[model samples]
Target: MERKMIRISGKRQITIPQKYFDLLGFDTEAECILRGNELVIRPVSERSGGEFAEAILADLISQGYQGDELLSKFKETQKKVRPAVKTMIDEADALAATGGSTASLDDLFGTEER
Candidate 1:
């Protein structure tokens, strides 16, 4: 285990140490949860892609994908999907900026209007 002391700046930003970054492989972003009187900083990991990976894996398995082949395929799929998702998010952001100060599900993701 490793330990370090950190100070919060006037802007309320604390820089996470490089030791922790190297150990955890988390970059730039984290989720801070206010638990009672204490603050819990958890890394926002994109490694697994969780639900997206699961859905893709299920579909691939149905098509006879498995083992190292499955892993390779999933990674390849990730490379392809990430950019498209980013584009959509960029478009959503631009739309939101022009329309309002916020992006809603219906405007950004084409969900049912509320």
Candidate 2:
């Protein structure tokens, strides 16, 4: 894709070009990202919480985990992760309530990538 220049106004807002808006559709909101020295804008996609679950189940199924065995393992993982997930959500809520900036998911989940 060819790069297009955009000027940020004194208010620190840059108008997203009409082409991007047209392509992404103005109906949905776009998420702005700051990655190192780069800025990225992407439309928010519909959430399917099952995507990761699907991946894990697919891998396990490939390895012969199925039916009752699959369900049992899933339950076990959920039992293990449920509390941690709640804790993460609580922490996120506390931070957001205080208007704090989180650097990454690593900061949120306490799992930093090297």
Candidate 3:
């Protein structure tokens, strides 16, 4: 991680180093998140949930949605992608912490008959 000793202004704002800001693709706005005792400032992606856009559009289109309805459904599904991914990540982390499943390959898939 890159470390910098930056001074905070009287208004409780610190200037991000140009190198870091450019590297992180910072624009006019940033998302400030408090994780534990650490404060993280990240660039706010203009295209949040954009990764799923093509797939969502394809599915919605195949489902016979078009016009304003297609656009509406696309927006709704796009909003859901991030939260759903977060939930999956949380679940995965929990499983990892618990050592995941106990079943072996044989137990799960069964062995060939002798």
Candidate number of the best TM-score: 3
lDDT of 3 by residue, 69-95 (tens): 999999998998787767766766566
lDDT for each of the candidates? 0.76, 0.71, 0.84
Residue-by-residue lDDT tens digits, candidate 2, 79-108: 545466668889987877787685467766
Collision pairs in model 1 = none
Ten-residue segment with the worst summed lDDT in candidate 1?
Answer: 105-114
Residue 56 local lDDT, model 3: 89
RMSD of each: 7.4, 8.3, 8.4
Candidates sorted by lDDT, descending order?
A: 3, 1, 2
- Model 2 whole-model lDDT (C-alpha atoms): 0.71
Error of 1 at 69 (Å): 3.2
Clashing pairs in 2: none
Better-scoring candidate (TM-score), 2 or 3 = 3
Q: Which segments of candidate 3 are over 4 A away from where they belong?
A: 1-15, 27-46, 101-114
Candidate 1 — which residues are off by over 4 angstroms?
1-48, 100-114
| Local accuracy of candidate 1 as per-residue lDDT tens digits, 1-110 | 66689999999989888888777777778878789999888787766454587778887788898999999998887666666676777888689768765757666766
- Prediction 3 global C-alpha lDDT: 0.84
Worst 10 residues of 3 by lDDT: 105-114
